[model samples]
Each structure stands twice: as C-alpha cells, then as structure tokens.
Target: MLIKGYDDGPLVAGEPLMTRPGFWSNHLMGMCDDGAGHPVPEWFGDDGADADALSEVLFDPGHWPVFRVPAAEGPGVVVVYRNQPGDYGIDYLLTPPGRSSTEQLTDWEGDLAENGLTWHELVRIADTPVHEAEGAADPAARLLLVLPLLNDLDLPAAAPARLGAALAAAGSPQDTVTHTAESLLAHLMGRSRHDADWASPLSGGY
Candidate 1:
C-alpha cells in the first residue's frame, strides 16, 4: 500500500538523520533524573564490538528514524523504537493522537492504558524494513501521512526527503525536548527544596 504523507511536493532524497547534540546524553539524563530513579536509555555500548543491537536506536537517529504511523484508533506518531535483531519484536513509545500537547499524557501508565494504547506489539507487518525503513513518514511534521497511500494503516515507501523538515517546523520533536526539559528541571528543583526544608531545623519539627 502506498503511504500517504503531509507534503505534496516532490521529495528530495537524503541520508539518515542524526539526533541533535545534547539530547540523548545531557538532556535526557537531566529529564529522567528524579528521586524515583528512572532509568534512561542506553545511548552507547562498550567501545568495541558486541554492542547491544538497539543500544543507540533512540539516541542515534540514524539507526532509529522518528516517523508517523496510523494508530489503531487515529493518527499517532512512532517516535523512538527498537526492534530485536531478527526484527521479531518491536517496542515503541507514541504520543496519543487528538491531544493538544504531549503534556496531556504526562501520567504515562494510567494515561496510555486508559486510551487503550500499549508500548509493544502494535503493528502486524510481514516484512519489517519494507514498511518502516521505506523512508521518513512525517518529515514535514504534519499530522497526516503525506506520501501516496492506498490505505491508512498500511503505509509504504514514503518520502525520506522530508526528514529534516520537522526540525524547523513548530511543535517538532525538538520542541518536545525543550518543553519536557523545562518541566522536568522545575520538578526536580522543587522537590529538592521540599526535601531540604524537611531536613532543616527551622522546619519546627523539633
């Protein structure tokens, strides 16, 4: 099936995209750090061979291209994903469609499940690369699939040319990173102050 996309203009061919600097390591680290100790993604492996196959997928965009796909219910985005070596298993994180901002899903577990979304085994495709590796699906950062589409769910070879376009588009992934970083930092800072007050003698517990 032909995959539909947002931009109707001719697509210019391009190579795989690399994740922006300071995202995976510094930015992601800062965001995921909380007293609860959430585990961040493994950005890299040992310096030699025998690296984890999906170790760098999300951190290194070249291995994991962010794209849009039809959700079971409506339009959704398949941002960062990792499939096994045989491509047998696919695990991904998506922002539920029809939301104004990803902030609506901040309560991830309760929110996603309430929306009937799961992080694993969503797509049922025969050939893994044919569907996903075809090209950048939502490079223009538009909601709908722009490339030609025979049907909605089954997207085919799309325009890789549009990949870099989202960087300049409003509400792009970069924007998500920026907003999330701000919120996370604020949360951590507030928590630190709260804890400090509890420990302080002036708190009047004594």
Candidate 2:
C-alpha cells in the first residue's frame, strides 16, 4: 500500500492501492550485471523507506524494481518485477498481505503453455519494464496486463473494464480503468462469488 501501509480492511481493483515498496531487507535490487568491482546502487536496500525515498527509486531508470498488486481479498498480495529477468519477461511473488506465505509465479516460463499466454507477447511486454516509469505501479495499467487471468483465480477488477475506454481517452494509457475505493469494494462484493458471501446480502433483514 505505498507509504500509507496496508489498510487491513479490504482492496478492490482500480482502487489505486499503492504497490508494496522495495525493502532494504525486502526491497528489490538492480538485476544488471554491470561487472563493476565496486558495489552497484542496486546492491543497496531500503526496506522501511518513506514516500519521498520510494518516489526517487520508482522513477529512476537504473533500477529494476518490484511492485505489488493486492488481491481483491487483500489476503493475497502479488509482487512483480518491472524488468525481465533474462529471457523471462517478468517475475512474481504471491503471499498474504503481510507476506506470511509466499509463492513465486514463474509459470510464464514452462507454465505459459498451460496458462495460455504467448511467450512472444510476454517477452514484448517485458521489454519495457513499467517500473522505469513514474506510474510504474499504476493500478489501472496493472489490471489490463493481468485481467485475462482473473477469471481462473479468486479476484476481481475493483474498477472493472466498464471504464477502460474512458481511462484511455483521458490519456493515461497505463491506467486501464479508474475507480473509487467504494466503487472497487462494491464491485468486489457484487461480483466475487467466492468472497461475496463473507457478509450476508441482507444481514439486517427481518
């Protein structure tokens, strides 16, 4: 959740929750093998970084940073690398909000065939690591990239694609849609069959 930290409440698509920040103990380092004898900037850590510090690294072209995207339930958190790690275009880590349990999503490698994603297309997307941009962690853009996979999983696009055209028309190509926190929450509650029942539709009904 960026500098504000996790809300422990709930998260929905297009809600603009901040991605997980890189850590000194938990942050990502530069992946380039500069072969420099001295320590590269990528070797450093910024685990408990503040907003201004994170902003600096996020916009720096030299770093191959990792960004987080919260699952609609918030119980699961998805972490992705902005740049390709060699032939693979992206790297991912899945865990709970606090990262209690972790799973890496490297299926895009041999698992691509099973998941139905084209290696060529993935490689193309990887070529331009979103982290290098100012809005590297834009919730809207992230949704577009991962939307196709939502149905197979237990998640939702809090903002939904209904606003895709409008977001694009507004000139933010990275943002697939725009949504308010309440809208996202409502979207999740209305559409997520798995999670919708967490609370009764009419708990207050007589």
Candidate 3:
C-alpha cells in the first residue's frame, strides 16, 4: 500500500503513522523505479537492494513509509511501528485472524509494554559470540539462534551433536518422537481452555 501520494487510497496500516517522521517524511523511497526518481531511501550501497519480492518490500517516500501485509482471514490490521512508538522486536501486531472483533485485538493498546527488541537487536543477539551473547538467556533470542540449525543449515559429522546441544539449550531438544513446532510456540505463550478454538491444530489448541 505504498502509494505514490495521498490520492492512491487509504493507509497500509492506518492513520497517525510515524513516531519519528524525520526519516519517512523527507526521503524519496520505494521499491519501484522510485517513481522514476534519481535516488530514494530504498537505495542500498552502490549496486542496490535484492528486491527479491515486491510484496514484501515496504517504505515509500511519497506516502507512508510502509505497506500492509494482510492477514490470512477476516478483516485484519497490522499495527506497524510507524503506527506507534517504541522499538519492540515486533514487526507488527495482529489478532489470530478469527471471528473476534478488531477491538478485541487492538483494544487498550496503550496498556501494552514497550520493552522489546528491534530487528537490529535480534540480528545482533543471534550473531553475538556465544559467550558474550547475554540475550541467549532470552527465549526469543535463543530461538532465533537455534532455528536455522533446525532447518536447512548444512552441517557435517560433528554438527549433529552441536545441533543437539544447541537445541537442548533452546529448550526445544529432540523428543522421543518429533516435536511439533506448533506446540512449542503455543506452549511458550501458555494456554487457556477458553482459547481452545483459537489454538493451532498443530499444537492441539487447548
């Protein structure tokens, strides 16, 4: 929804976006030909960005610097950083994409806390030296570090043991059978019988 101007349509997220308008306002940015501009903030280094996917790219200098990534079902909104303050690791906020009213997901947003990491912090923590990475104690940070090992990470003979050790440290060690990813994420956030219907089937909901 990074429209070229106010005439494009409505907002990608919503109104009153941008806490630090300093960057989003004055910069000519976007993933297009920059609307045929000479230079835009989307420009990176000498060559350019790896615009591998257009739908995933955000930032538009002509309008709001962000575009909405829609939810899979129902009417949904992603509360982006531009729409609010603080540097939480949260890329955005959204409900479970169910029948719940938007208010139920967005209500009392002021009551939410701001003490979370940013993308930069997450990358740093994930890349930090094993001994020095204090954020390793944090489940989110630890998860970030170990997740790649669980996926396509190419490891040789000793890597199995290393991966095992890393998984154990992340509290996601191999189970007698395979551990269901859905269960891990859902259980991390805890469960409520009332929320059974909203639960992930992979996690068995309730």
Candidate 4:
C-alpha cells in the first residue's frame, strides 16, 4: 500500500485545491510539512540533481527507485517506483507553497493520471477499531496486525515486519506493542520498507 500527501493547508470546500504546484512538489517528495511553515525540497530531476533524464523512467511499468531528503526550506520532492522486469513505473509527489493537506493528497492521486502511473488510493481505516486481544499484549502480534493494516492502506509489501518485531521485543514487551503501532503508522506513510533504501527509515534499522 502507498500513502502520500503534502503539508500545506486544509482542503477547502468547492475549491479544487489539488492543482497547486506546491502540492505536486510535495507529493513527489512523499513528505510535507503539517502546514506549520516548514520547508519543502526541490524536484529530483528538474535540474539533473541526480534524477534520471528519461520521462519514461517514471512510467516504465517496472520496479524503480525511491528518493527522499531531510525537511528543508524551499521545495521538496519524493518519488517511489517499482522495478519489475520489462515494467518500470514511478509515482511523483511534491510540496509546494500555500496549499491544504487534503489538496496535497488529492494532487498526489491526480499525478498518477498526469504521469501515467497505475495506482489505487488506500481505503480509510478510521472505522477499524483497535480491540484488546492477547496480541495487543505481544508487540510482534501487534506489529503483524498493524503491518497488514498499513498494507491495506497501500504501503509497500517490503515494509519491515522484523524491525517492528524487534522494536516490540526490545523494551517492556508492552512497549513493543506501541512500537508495532508506530511501525504500522510509519508504513502507511511510506516510512519503513526493506526494499525502500532510498526512502525507508528502516534502511539503517531505525
């Protein structure tokens, strides 16, 4: 599952907010500020800043690379792609200035069409209630539950379940449960995937 949005303003009613340029930039970058006056990174390939020059590289119908950078001033861009044989595809997200959060999310969804990438929006789990089960007491079990949920939310399958387990195992065992929850949250937000070295926080086991 993949989840992407920008940190701008709140989506307004009756106004199409997804067309903003900042939303495009933030959506491509995968991370945006929470509308709290934070910085956004620049486009990866706009000026040959280490991004491939081929527009086809973004929609080749295969597995591709993901890119991310620290929260900085100016513009920010992030992209995630799959590198399957004979098929390469990429997703673009960016954080432009003066937009709402919902607008940013909507733009990320819209960019799929603009960039010719195939994808589906994740279903909202706000109705899924957290129950008190034995697994809730075991971090590993909790992590497992959360992982699948994030997967349901469109996070990549390569997310680190083992890391969630380890984080669950390290502390008071109960603390692991929280870690698992956090892991699920991170995954939903495209933060911790094993194959996502370019953007995965788990790249260094953190």
TM-score of each: 0.22, 0.31, 0.21, 0.18
lDDT string, candidate 1, 4-99, tens digits = 231222222222332333222322233333446553333211121212232343334334333434333433433332222433222223333454
lDDT of each: 0.27, 0.32, 0.28, 0.29
Candidates in descending TM-score order = 2, 1, 3, 4
What TM-score should be assigned to candidate 1? 0.22
What's every prediction's RMSD, in angstroms? 19.7, 16.6, 18.2, 19.7
The CA-based lDDT of model 3 is what?
0.28
For 109-181, candidate 2 gives per-residue lDDT tens digits of: 3222122222222222323333533333444444433322222223234233433432342232332123222
Candidate 3 Cα errors over 4 Å, as ranges: 1-10, 13-46, 49-62, 65-91, 99-206
Cα shift from native, residue 148, model 2 (Å): 5.3
Off by over 4 Å in 1: 1-15, 19-31, 36-116, 122-127, 135-206
Per-residue alpha-carbon lDDT of candidate 4 for residues 1-206, written as tens digits (9 for 90 to 100): 22243212121121121222232222233332233423222321122222233334343443233432111222222333433444333333432323211112111332222111111111111112223311122323223212221222243443344433433343224433443334334434542332322222111211
lDDT of 3 by residue, 78-169 (tens): 33323222422213232233433222122112222322222222233334333431112333323332221121112234433433343344
Cα lDDT for residue 138, candidate 4: 34
Q: How does residue 101 of candidate 4 score in lDDT?
A: 19
Candidate 1 Cα deviation (angstroms), residue 150: 28
